[model samples]
Target: MTFEFTADDQLYQLAIVLVAGIIGGELVSRVHLPKVTGWICTGILLRGLEPYHASFSGLTTSAVSSFAPYMSFVLGYIAFTVGAALHFASLRNSGKRLGFLLVGEALVTPIVVMAVMYFIGGWLKPDEMTLRTSLILAAIGIAAAPGTTVLVVQETRARGILTRTLVAAVALIDMVAVGVFVFATAYLTGLGDASADWHEHWQHALVSVAIEFGAAFLVGTAAALIALGLTRTIVGPAFLGPTMVAVILGAWGAAVGFGYSGILACTFAGIMVSNIRHDTVRATGAYLHSIGGVLFAAFYTFAGMKLDFSLVLEAAALVGLYFLSRFVGKYVGAFAAMSLADVPTRVRNTLGLALLPHGGVAVGLILLVQENVHLQDIADTVTTVGLAALAINQLLGPSGTRFALTQAGEKGKDLPRLLDFLDEQHISVDVTGKNKEEVVRCLAAQLYATASRPSLPQEEFIQRVFEREQAASTCLSQGLMVPHAILDEGEAMTGILGISSEGLDLPTPDGRPVHAVLLLATPDTDRKRHLEVLAAFARTITRDLNLREQLYHARSAAHAYDVLHAEESEEFNYFIEDALTRAGAFSENKT
Candidate 1:
């Protein structure tokens, strides 16, 4: 059973976990469960099999620790995307109910858990560390893994108010958890030392907390600017990919190096990028998301492998108590707050269920607590209980989230997006024209030649675009124009992308020559869909200067199509499709 953990063995175990995770995920998905559940279960199974293969089963806690850096990157990426969801425009009018719901769940979950654990923990453990453990656990209680919740949402194809709210809520609560944990741990650092002055310690803890958050915020903001500058300057994905990864990892590393919350810093960076340049966030996010499956699979599987069920047996009472108390606190707090906020009855009832998964953030917090010098005395007990409870939470959390989305009638509604209409055939590179009218006519002819001809004559399609253009210039600032029209008879939406690096002589409000012209034709019956498509295109192209630059410089129609269909741009597509569906824009499709 004794084996020297070598680098080779780590690689071997990594390969096994990845393959096993994919297989496990596939199996669980067949049985109608979240793939994350399967991945975690597979990790636990691998851990259980460790003694059977001493060298290969290096999936023990030590082996899992070796992958900590990789996991940090994955969590950072997830946090960044979650942060991007915190756009101010969306949250500004989300209403006081969302605010109250957030406060209710956030404040109530920890208070209730802390109260329950403090009193019950004293009765069960009867130790000096009981209060500290309760406080620490309660602090950790607020974090729900945005990564897991978002995966479930993505897996279920859920979109709507409930999904958006839940994702944002989980992300916000996690940041709150980080802040609370930092302060609580700081205050408790030397609290039990007889020689330490409690008053001075409290004062120092306050200063430490402020510095921790303030420095993290600065690190994140600086990271955001770096990302913006790179994307704005770096034109191609070949160089952009590595640069983005470096920026994200470097930001996380810097925060951690400074003894701050790396996750929070990444989250803040994402928020800044999302609000400042949504196109950049979406494009980068889509690229990251392309590889998210493997990263998440490895992460959750590693998480499962690190669990020691022996601790569960030893702290069965405490573990059971923590699990029940935390769940009750989350549900009651969410339901109560939503009710008070006058939220819809279904949301008020089920939103709490969606918040049940406390994955990476909670696990990270407990690990931090274990490593703290002041918290060392109770580390063993806390780890035993905390990990056990986390195992239970991770196992149930995804299912809870899936159930909530299903009940909310928001599942499987994210398909048939606006981007679905555009293909290589619909794109033309180096499109030339003497004026805006000539460009519109050429784009319309190309659209007809490549795709199905609409019931309306091709000339009329050109006329409609001209008519709409006359009403108000579709020219979005920064060399982009979206000339769209509603076709009287068309089964679905179709479009063409004309890349004119030389610039079209379109009369733009900003007076910039249009370098990219997006011609959109929507079925008259689905007029609202046209508006949504126009908005999506305008937002995406205008906000992402990198994408615009690449598209303009594209060498061929296929190249332009690739630039448009690149994975980095898919996040914005998903967001628009989901948001539009929720708004009833796509409820009544033309065909």
Candidate 2:
């Protein structure tokens, strides 16, 4: 039957997918879960409509089929963006340990999986399946999904030896597994033919995978070289961005046209663009961020549409076997590898856990294998197992990473942060007089007292600030003092004003003294952050002539800050009008 989708039907289908996908993704993200799982699960659940399956069966017809490939293209860009984030030297240090672990897992996972599958196949339907069936099933078990794993890690903002090592290890290992898969798949297709040389199988698989990667690499390399040359010819880092994205998509196209590995191509291309005698990082980062939204949206929604509940209903057995193989391969390998490398105990423990994410690499590989001729059964098995494993990984990966980080003492500890009600704030009034040192000291004391801060035991806080003032005048040309200190306080940003009716003789980074001092204080927040706040405030002060004069003529702290707020409010969005050429990105908020 011809399935013609009316505009309303198309809109309905899209709305369902998008809304369900977003809600699921947001719900998962709220609970610190991997977004990929949320998206995929949303798709699976939508496909899980036991009653509506028949109603929407025609949704998968020709018109809708086009959407899937379009989604795939977007997914390809997302994949390229991920590749672009990878630093070339990320795997440099852990090469030996990672290699040993990856090789051992790749080889052992297949063997262990084959053994289990053979037994399970015997138990389930002894006369139905053969040894080749077990091998094929086992090969799928050997593959890992690098996409969701990467997602899980990225969500945690995970850093440390273990996280970095896991990322690099999985990336390299997945690439090798593709080659392993190629040979295993070829052998399965050969199917016990006595004349079919297994060696020839390896040669063919390796050649096919390698050629795909090589052509893609060549195209990407040339594209990056061209971009670099162009960036040199034109002396701004701006155009390099658009050029880099074009290179990524162009490489993606070459990979498809030549039947090459797009991941390898894009990965190589990103590295070349970043390293090829040009500073393309900012440009590349912007390009990646710009497309992140649409790619993620499409990826999640598409994933939801592909979820087949029937396969997942049969997921119980597949999930068990897939993880069993991974456990036998990954943990055992990790423990052994770390021990061999003499890694410290705490890190070694975390490494075992950190190495468990199977993301897009595994999923994409499963799809590729699924498309392979003669090994269609194997591919089906891989996809089923992969989707199942991905579901589980998405649920567990982030939480596990969080656990490891907390255990390693790398968790962000939010300290005693006084949430200064900045929506509308005013510092207390200051009343004191001049002697330079005496007036500043009295001002500090009044602030500490009024704010209920513990008095400095030796007045060293005040003295130290004064000594810093000695290095340079804290006074600006118009008489504003920004005396800041690196105090041993908790992480917080507070504004306190010091009143000196006669003013203090304090030096500025500029070369003047004797006037108004805005004692900027921070606890544990980094110096750069404090500087950012100062710079932001500085821009405000420097922008308005009347506001600066009012601040200069300030009698009390509360009154001064009122004018400060008025000034900040008036010019808070200077960049939209003043900083740029009011383009689309800038004008999005422009008046």
Identify the leading candidate in terms of TM-score. Answer: 1
Model 2 lDDT per residue over 19-95, tens place: 77778888877866657667767766665553564365334423345575555455455455445545443332345
Model 1 ranges with Cα > 4 A deviation: 1-9, 56-58, 190-202, 234-241, 417-591
- Model 1 clashes, total count: 1
Candidate 1 residue lDDT tens string, 52-107: 76554545666678888988998898888888888764453344556776687558
**Model 2 per-residue lDDT at 532:** 56
lDDT winner among the candidates?
A: 1
Model 2 score (lDDT): 0.57
* Candidate 1 local distance difference test against the native: 0.78
